[model samples]
Target: MSIPDTASMPMFLRAEDFSFSDEFSDLVEFSFLPGRDDMVPWVEYSGGLPPKSLWGDSICGENTITIQSDMYDFLDMGALSFVPSDETLLKILETAEHNRKCPLDDRITLGDDIPEFNTELCEYTLTIARSITETIFTRDPYTGIVQEHSPPYPDIPRFKLTANPWMVSTHAYGAAFCHRIHLPLVQRVGASIESGTLPTVFKPVFKPASFRRNNVPTLTCGTSGSDVA
Candidate 1:
């Protein structure tokens, strides 16, 4: 699962957008279908590497939630460079402006206000946008790969991109942060995957003894508009 261009791109939506490192040391869990456990693609993706992931658990509403993330913020450079038809260029510019600069300062408190993220969210958007451009123009993975099933995506790469644990962590952390902020972070993620990056699997950390499972789940397109608000 190579990294996609969406890993670094700018994105904004009405209510839109959107790792791990602890498991390698002592704690361990083995399963036949680790995909059900939801922690494989990321594990394998980060093997023999430093922590590109982040994790935490908190009470959201009533259920205790456990979060382990290995995803990324891909950019959509093509979209940026894309010169829309004259009929809709103005709308594109307007939408870009709105997303790039969200005016609502009314902060929502997640478990607590994450100070670092407060300043970094805007900055990350810019970086994520760049990821899209760079991944698309520079990598060119999807250009050569064959999508046997006639997949919806056109330019996604054939395999994993370089390790950027922060890529996955950024989105995951953002969602968690959204939880604190009382924003629809989860919804934002869905929008992003549709509009920004690819679907991520819960990758396995360790090479399997018998077989390889395409587990780590990437983001997916659901019944939601693609964008992060």
Candidate 2:
């Protein structure tokens, strides 16, 4: 089944706002149905999933994902050491400062000796800095094909901070990043598809017959509708 064009879809919706029509319910269910073990071979092969980080076991307590002090210090220095050609990082910092809940404003008056500044605030700041750096430095997969494609680093000037400083600071940074950077990249992908300019590397094709799951017999392609025979 073909996916609907998202350009016409609403930007946001609440769960209480809408329900699937009865006629389309079955189609939706079928579309999302979990893949059967027998049908695995019919799918195209992509690269293997990334290995889990070795540091996964280290994080603990309420701040499970918080960055370690030494790492946070390194990221902090990295963020401040180099200025981007644009004001993106400055704007990010400005947005964080204006946020009443953000630790920035508080940290400014409290001097450099505060414990939270060394810990929680430091972690949040490092996260934001690393995210922005990744956006600016990463190369596009289809860089040559999409000449117009560029990173729309989120306009931090227009960003608004929420009341809960820690949560709001992190969330706002992420939302802005996605809205500015990731969304445009996705739109570029769709444009590539529509224009039939997608690179050959991206085109999906069937995997070899030798591809097996748990030593099971592979099903024949384009026949018997996912049966094992």
Candidate 3:
């Protein structure tokens, strides 16, 4: 399936590959561990999956397709403090801070007087602090914004949900995480730049080749020891 300018994107849990219905599905469950009670028990499933469609590294269900990680990064408990995957994010920040764009770059610097935090996201108004994170993305005062390299805490990707949503709540997790990094950093960039402010919104553009839709579609996939209610 050739991708258009935009994807009518939906979220997923244990996603394998993309599908028609997954694009339109309203929500996805993400959990860090098994036996978590956060999923909606499905009485009926509906995604126009082509014959033999599958999701993720494996299948998701009998009739559903797993969303491609290429298009989306599925987050679960692993992505929490455990996964610690933020190098890519920091590199992206360095690029934006130095170049005023999101291309890759090596010219990173840490500001001599950066603010400090000693509390959890729950301790503070995260939505406001998140604006600071967005600033890290756009105006990164810290030149060497390497993850876990110089920290009391690592620069990992995570969320401060009222609930512990993980792989199952992939939609909620992804959207919230996206919102966390996307909005705050962009907002900070607008306020930090010496020149005119840039757009305080992050718009990720998927590569062109990924839109190819000539492949097969219907998928049978799900995590082992897990069942859709």
lDDT of each: 0.23, 0.23, 0.25
TM-score for predicted model 1 compared with the true structure:
0.17
Residue 12 lDDT (model 2): 21
Of 1 and 2, which scores higher on TM-score? 1
Cα shift from native, residue 187, model 2 (Å):
12
Candidate 3 at residue 43, lDDT?
Answer: 6
lDDT score for candidate 3 against the true structure: 0.25
TM-score of each: 0.17, 0.15, 0.19
Q: How many residue pairs clash per model? A: 66, 1, 46
TM-score of 2: 0.15
lDDT of 3 by residue, 1-229 (tens): 7543323422111222221222323334333322212211110111112212221122232212222232223333222111111332233234335544432223222211212110111111112212222211111111212222122123322322222111222222233454454444333322322232322222122335544333333322343322210
Better of 2 and 3 by lDDT: 3
Question: How many Å off is the CA of 181 in candidate 2?
Answer: 29
Q: Over all chains combined, what TM-score does candidate 3 have?
A: 0.19
Better of 1 and 3 by TM-score: 3
**Candidate 2, which segments miss by more than 4 Å at Cα?**
1-12, 15-17, 20-192, 208-229
Kindly state the number of residue pairs that clash in model 1: 66
